[model samples]
Target: MQTVANFTPNSIVGEIEKVLDTYPYNPYQQAFSIPDIRQQLIEYVLVRIPCADSSCSVESSQENTNQVPVSKIPRTPLQHQLHLQNLIHQGICVIMQMKSELISQILCETVQPVCEPSHWFG
Candidate 1:
């Protein structure tokens, strides 16, 4: 039985990195090149996903309690992989949205106010 503890966040990171590798030449790839940014996205996704067992839910797990046996429905390896891939896609969407908002805020802050032209008669 694969316990929730066995599913490390690094596994999710590895899977995400594999998908990112396919877009090596993408213009936005540089954002993920920073390890911290990539890690943040992984953390975001992990926090949103429920643990396989309620006892080890993301909320309680953060408290750093010792691992305890949890009863839950078992999923085949293929099913688990597909579920993870779906999550990776969702995480990528979130990163893109955050990047867009950041860029918009920077542009708003740096934009200069345009002066109105004086009338020729004036």
Candidate 2:
């Protein structure tokens, strides 16, 4: 896997902007790619976006000499909980952004000059 040592905030914002720019502006019907865009954004946050800390090992298991002597896991339930919350937050943020983008596209489409559909009927 290629590491993202040089990832910057501007690049992140650029990616979001790129998606927004390409988004379908049709307000009467939803964009066919909106669902795909959502999935892509979610995947980008969960997988493609690199972590700032390369030292942290998500798969590292700690040995504990405690009560039941069960197999050790990489992370605690609390960590997982926090991680899930973070993902949810990120997802919501992206969705909200898309909402604004969709609105912008709708407005832009509405403001543009309209043409008759005479070619379609003929």
Scored by TM-score, the top model is 1
Clashing pairs in 2: none
TM-score of 2: 0.32
- The TM-score that candidate 1 achieves is 0.55
TM-scores of the candidates are 0.55, 0.32
Give the per-residue lDDT of model 1 (tens digit) for 31-62.
Answer: 56656667877877677555622324222233
In model 2, the runs with Cα more than 4 Å from the true position are 1-33, 48-74, 103-122
Scored by lDDT, the top model is 1
Poorest 10 consecutive residues of model 1 by lDDT?
52-61
**How close to the true structure is residue 5 of candidate 1, measured as C-alpha lDDT?**
35
Query: How many residue pairs clash in all the candidates, one count each?
Result: 0, 0
